[model samples]
Target: MSERGRGDRRGGMSRGGRGGAVRGNRGGMGGRGGRGGGGDRRKGREGNNNRQAKKKGGSKVIIEAHRHRGVFIARGKEDMLVTLNMVVGNTVYGEKKVVVEGSSPEEKKEYRQWNPFRSKLAACILRGIRDIYMGPGSKVLYLGAASGTTVSHVSDIVGPTGAVYAVEMAHRPGRELIEVAKIRTNIVPIIEDARYPAKYRMIVPMVDVLFADVAQRAQAQIFSINASNFLKNDGHFVISIKASCIDSTVAPSTVFSKVRDELIENQFKPIEQISLEPYERDHAVVTGVYRPSKKEKAPE
Candidate 1:
């Protein structure tokens, strides 16, 4: 593992620019948008049928829209709800909140789609995270909020007042992110590189939790630099590391070891290390406390 100095400036970073940045999760679909190939007309037809059904369904779980993996179903598929849902509905809005909506007078509609691959909160739970600081009103810096799938869940968890800085450097994904932000005013979209936190600092407020899913080699260093400027001292830092991106030449264990050491050097305390199997291949999720001055503990 090379010490890509902060701002992503390191031995391996020469291939890419040296600015810190994060946000993008197509749930491992390779970040390609919904422009599914080989069936252009079919896409339009399917959308029409779904919309027609939703218009007549009336307070039902209508298959409202289509994304890459599946269709978006909604009960109040009305214009207002549709508009609101587009914002915090499927993106990470940075607030930690749990909304209990009742489908019927006696029924409870309490649930949020948990995408383990994109959002580390679900990944950490699968990895057995005892306590995630992502509950109600928690401020979060959501990195890699591609297309807003997992970010929507984060918005539900964080609620309204709290904010989430959804950062994405990719233009294609950033467009969708902007749409999601338009409805969810709390989420501020920054179409800048994550390696350079200062560049996007004006849009960013202090955050209690920093969640990153950037599949870059110098991720640990990127997180460190971002944390110094953004994360609260005792706040939480959740990172999803793609083993293949780090050092493909060495074993996964070696790569993880090197990255963990670097995090320690940067003053982050590693509390949990987890592997995401069904969701991501040979990928790992790490949850750590940002301790800028304390002695780092041994890797768990």
Candidate 2:
């Protein structure tokens, strides 16, 4: 009777163990299926996000050449200057940046950032000065080239055929100008005082334009002297006059009038005078012809 009882107990334990194994298998399969579905859903969301980004802005960059010659407009969800990089992958003074979209071994194209805030010339350009006179292949005699920041942009505009004679008096800034000139072959950096144009007489030839940004009491005199030496007959002159530099106590209008009169007296015919009020207060850019020959002079 004891043996029969023990055999019956063993058979019952075997059946219970088989039932648990079948239930465990079903639970395991359901958990795996749920996990797989969750993973697929996450992947679908990631793909949707990528598609949306592409629709918002098709590409990373889009550059269009500007209407103005030697200028370009860059659009990367924003608008900015399409400038040529003087030093590849390097900035002179924390200016904007634009990458060259298409380039090749035979011909390399590069673009750098032109910031209006940093460069007065750039501001003037944006202000719509009809003829800057410093275009491609133009010979420019630039006075007061501070650190060559503007000079470098001018170099890019003028291209290899053109030349820029940058003159800065101070030693420290002159050193920086030299570095910029080294990179851009067309620039001729002259570390000499602009007040005395005769000092560097041998280096500068008759230029198409004479640009002066000196902040001296006699700003007109400095420009007159330089134009007389280097500007060709009927050549243009763009002078940036700062009223405070001339006389802080005097009214800004008074200062501008005085400068304009002085320029006419020196034989520079004033064509148009524009005030850089919003960009720069108490500052004006005077554009005119330097000593036009009697034949070339227009009728009043």
Candidate 3:
């Protein structure tokens, strides 16, 4: 049996819809996780009221930041909108210092940002994923961390106390991710294909969340293999599926169904699935819980 519900499609709002519309005070994030800063303060429209922080040195560059709801607006050279609950500043090794302090992150709560592009996480937010649980101290397995755009946000979310094992198959991007991780203590970038978690088993700890953005032909299998070894029993697997990546011949729905079946066989219970349109074409971010059988459950 299978259950279906709404999925996270945050940054997707910028798609199909006119990108220019975001240029207004609202500032549409056309899928790039629009990082805005500076200029006159706007009205009391609450941003993301979650925790916020920063990394700096002897007032080298004081990034003026404001909190609104779950949004963090940094007034530096440019106006940047990051989630207060996620991470504080860019993970730049030599200069990565918490300029401002923030509340500790939650271990098992889903958090989103107001990014309109560059990451499926942003799309998932715009789509309204009420079940997302990316918070502090969370051990996340990021499948596709390209150039560390969304990885930075995730690093902020997990905070210094938490850990994020970013897995990227591409060497170039993985190198950049490693560099980024150098600044942030929590993010540990691993240069390996997410398909083979066993090879990197020594590095990846049991994770609270398995976030996969790798759009591949055998993505479901990829998620299954990785989840089997690393996903915690109560953990959640957040996967972004691209229809084209699965099969161009059959319908997108078929691809999703097959993927779900594969995950179910792997002991992952389906939670939610929603199409990531506008932001990402023919794509979806699916959430599932990994609950072992009574026999598989370890002694408490």
Find the candidate with the highest lDDT and give its number: 2
Candidate 2 lDDT over 161-239, as tens digits, reads 8899999999999999999888889999999999898999999999998988899998899888998899999999998
* Residue 282 of model 1, lDDT score: 74
| lDDT score, candidate 1, position 24 | 18
For model 1, residues 53-148, the per-residue Cα lDDT tens digits are: 334421223223312111122232221111123232232432211123345644422223343544555555645555556755678898877876
TM-score of each: 0.63, 0.76, 0.65
TM-score ranking, high to low: 2, 3, 1
The candidate, 2 or 3, that scores higher on lDDT is: 2
Tens-place lDDT digits, model 3, residues 1-300: 111111121111112132421211334223323343332233111221110111111111223322212233333322333443343333322111213332544332222233545668767766776565677677888888876767777777667777888888999887888777777677888888877788899998788999888878888888888888888887888889888888999998988888888888888888899877777888888887888546667788
- Candidate 3 residues lying further than 4 Å off, grouped into runs, are 1-81, 85-114, 292-300
Lowest lDDT block of 10, candidate 1: 2-11
Candidates sorted by lDDT, best first = 2, 3, 1
The CA lDDT of each predicted structure is 0.60, 0.71, 0.62
Which residue runs does candidate 2 get wrong by more than 4 Å?
1-62, 65-67, 86-90, 103-108, 295-300
List runs of model 1 lying over 4 Å from the truth: 1-110, 117-120, 292-300
